[model samples]
Target chain A: MRETESAAEARPYHHGDLRRALIDAARRILETKGPAALSLRAVAREAGVSPAAPYHHFKDKGELLDAVADEGWRILNEAMKAAGENAPSPRAAMPSLGVAYVCFAREHPALYRVMYKRSRDKEALPEHLHEGEDSAYCRTRDTLIAAGADPSDPVGLELATIAAWCAAHGLAEIGGFQQFAHLKEALGGEEAFFRGVFEHMGVFARGLND
Target chain B: MRETESAAEARPYHHGDLRRALIDAARRILETKGPAALSLRAVAREAGVSPAAPYHHFKDKGELLDAVADEGWRILNEAMKAAGENAPSPRAAMPSLGVAYVCFAREHPALYRVMYKRSRDKEALPEHLHEGEDSAYCRTRDTLIAAGADPSDPVGLELATIAAWCAAHGLAEIGGFQQFAHLKEALGGEEAFFRGVFEHMGVFARGLND
Candidate 1:
């Protein structure tokens, strides 16, 4: 089996694959051994390449970590979009978007923490905050707009988006408390509790009776 | 001024005052030099005491940090109480409770981070989460109950409490972003912006039209 796959495996060290390979290796190290174990040399080792090989792609550990964080954002954005799209309606998508956001943070705690901690110093909204059509903020904003949130009042729309984002983020921050274990179970486990809270918050979600 | 205050300053080295003095010094160091610069030795120097003085109260840097964090919790609780009490109505107090929560995080970010980071490992709710009538959680819970949230449905009340807490925590997490400067100004300022978001989330706060 090893002999048959060797040819395909050898492609990892190729110029185009090395960066992606290194990032993938870094991600594994991040989840398995935690952030402290990550370094260019270690990533190179994990990628099964020569120690100097990572230098061709990432100039230093910071660059490699940045690449890893970028990957986290991409995946997180996709998760939010998928969760939103799976919802029955645009009105319901708001909570789904929040639930997915918190789920992403819970699933990849180290990567999630590192991702935002880096952006925090920038004193501006990170890329996920309404920068483009695919950005998480815009997705949330679009959902709210579809749900009959006022599109004309740009400031009102932004505050409403912040309200929803902050609710998800705040839940992620302390959602793991054992005190909530009973409530979470009672509410039909974590996702239900999240959707419940999101619905209860209901920035534009006026149809709880429905 | 020094000649008059020397006698009062002399009180800080007293047994009870020494511990408080050390925490105050640590707080100053935390804000000025950041967490990396903290050590029992550094705190002793900041407190203007013998290098060995901190040992009498705190056995290690960790103990000293725990003490500092305790002081932070006390201050945060007081802020929440004041905010809740100041609100004109029980319904409005929910947002007020959240506003003060975020304000505390903003005013003393380093201490606030240290406080919660230590609690994160416990996998349980922190002391402020409905442990007593004085705790922040109960204050929010009591406010909600006063405002018509069902006390008999303890689970419902608990979920509502969490929603409000997370909103505040999440805002504090990213409330410093410069992107909100214009909105903050348009809302009449930062506190107003916080109130708006909190009202928008409104957990059990359905009277947004009010």
Candidate 2:
């Protein structure tokens, strides 16, 4: 009886850090299988806890999904910030951000989908979502400014940033290997793809100077 | 009993023309309700038939979705072609095509999602789907050539076309109200949003000439 109880306690819900463990497990499953495969019971099982343990942290699936989405946004914001900090100049930094954006999308495809796909509104959105989005956008906008773009008339900068993001996000959303094939044949490669997108951003930026 | 039986008998397995009926019903539901609500049963019900009726015409939900996505491409191609047919020049035709592209997205958001969602495979895409996309691209490419763009350069043409589509599709995907807001702020209204997208298209084309 004592040995059986010990075995059961090894997977207990009230273990020292079950909540965070559950979130980590959920993220791992989402990254591997995609959002459609994510389930509370499955997550609990993977975390080596009882089936009912997840409810202690998340009221429902949406809450769990929202938490994941919020975390994705935070990761994105951090990546954008790091890209900005590491670039030598604005022009150099701008394309690096594009690369970072694509890398983030590819490396965390499921999380990216969870962040954007049928995203919850502000009311339902976890607390960190808006700040994360704003941080990412501000990083781009400020990098454009640092590159000699006018802070006063920022529309062109916004358009350029948006365009670069669109192209990178577009290519990445299509996936890596296939995107490499399609883009490399025509545009030279992933680097060239970013160059074209960044070049377009330049053109859009120059339009503002005019 | 006799009348009810006759009515039931009238709704045959072949559906008197199920393929066309499914397409039409799909379009109707897409326009009236939205894309998320779409289902084979809903489509069958809309056509006044049983759930099994759609299975005869389509293998599964994806097949039905693929059919609708194909239809969306065709409709978009037709709108683009019609917009380009009688413009003052290819330059003028380009913006018209851009406008029409946005219009299609706005009028059919669900179909728009079905068309652009990341999961769909280009290689496995149904024949009509590729045909419709090719036709749409040809219209833009032809317009670019007519507008003094180099005809020999496929690479430049594709880049310009992608940029154009991205602008239109992005505007459309963001929703109609935002389109109107963007237009009002930048172009003076949604009408101007169309102009801004094409004006940028022209900008990209001229970059080639330079």
Candidate 3:
């Protein structure tokens, strides 16, 4: 970082800019070097602030990472909501959310890993994390209910929502991440894979009708 | 670990048993403390062997963890096979395998986490892991084929197998490992949860038939 002194010097953290600078730098480092590479000092340096500056906004690296993940979920919720809005029906909406999830995981592998894979330090996951989670679940749950699921019974609703989530999540982990990129195309590619699962799920939805 | 010194000292390494002793020690530590607690020195100490002794049997911690995971998969595969063995029909065996999977994960969370959660280090996984994976897949795939599904096409078989695996894994993670455990009795419990999912899936399957 010191090698690029001029770049650092040009970007001093102004009163209102330090926090945003730190978050942006953290995201860059997370993308280029992954969550393990994230450090408060590094973020502070990247933001052209004294090492002490990040402490003003984040208590520790975990808090910063948590904020990043929180932001990620928020971003993900928006993407899922947007995609679901375009679907012709609630059943059609389901695959779009599934695809959107896989797409987000693929696009933000590092953030996704920190958000879900690592045992999150609660310091990073604030109270708002639940709100983000609930919002995402609401998108899915509402789709199921609209498509004829009985939301009054939490049992079936939760089961189906979790099933779709795990399918998408496992597929993303097994395909979208670097570990299994080699198998992605063969795993019916992401689009076909999700469509196939959702199509199968549509078959399962018939039981609700019965 | 030091608390068990007397027991450790009583059972010396090469009493026609060192390998099994080390394996047992690894499992014990893993069960109590999860994978991060696994250490060659610790296992050696627990087994009453010199620190260097484990290298003679397992190259490193990843190798040791892989071995433990393999062992877990072997047990899981056997349990799954046993579930299939006495089931009434091929279709019955499929959900039985799902039940066995959930039961195994709930019964041995640590072992299940080690088996699936840990990033598979290729240098450590060897053919045994793949063999175990194939064994589990074939157990379900063959059953699906016996139930009159086409197995000659790889894509169809992969989809069904993965879908089934995802359902079982999702159920276990949500029903056993997640906060849903607290809601189990009130939420109609694991049996009802699985029944609802599979029943819906059965409806979906019939849709494919139509």
- In TM-score terms, candidate 2 sits at 0.78
lDDT of 1 by residue, B22-109 (tens): 9899999999987658778898899888889988888877677877888888899999999888888765666667778999998888
Off by over 4 Å in 2: A1-3, A15-19, A39-45, A48-56, A120-134, A154-168, A174-182, A185-189, A200-210, B1-14, B118-134, B147-152, B175-188, B197-210
Best candidate, TM-score-wise? 1
RMSD of each: 6.5, 4.8, 5.7
Q: Considering only N, C-alpha and C atoms within 3 Å, which residue pairs clash in candidate 3?
A: A66-A124, A203-B204, A204-B204
> A1-210 in candidate 3: lDDT tens per residue?
445557534543355767777889989989988766787888887777788888888877767776777788889888888888887765566567777887898788778877764432221223443354357776776766666666787766666665666556655555432422333467547677655654544322331233
lDDT of 2 by residue, B1-210 (tens): 335656544654445788888888987888888765677889889888888878887888777777778778878878877888867654466667767888887666778777765233342223342344358766665665665555686665555554454556545644343313543477466556545544443232222123
The DockQ values of the predictions, listed in order, are 0.32, 0.23, 0.24
lDDT score, candidate 1, position A122: 53
After superposition, which runs of candidate 1 have C-alpha atoms over 4 Å from their true positions? A1-22, A35-63, A202-210, B1-22, B39-63, B202-210
Q: Give lDDT tens digits, candidate 1, residues A73-143.
A: 88988998798889877556666677899889888877886676555645455555557888888887787
Q: Record all residue pairs in model 2 with backbone atoms less than 3 Å apart, i.e. clashing.
A: B183-B189
What is chain B's TM-score across the candidates, in the order shown?
0.79, 0.77, 0.76
Better of 1 and 3 by lDDT: 1
TM-score of each candidate? 0.80, 0.78, 0.76
Top-down DockQ ranking: 1, 3, 2
Docking class of 2: incorrect
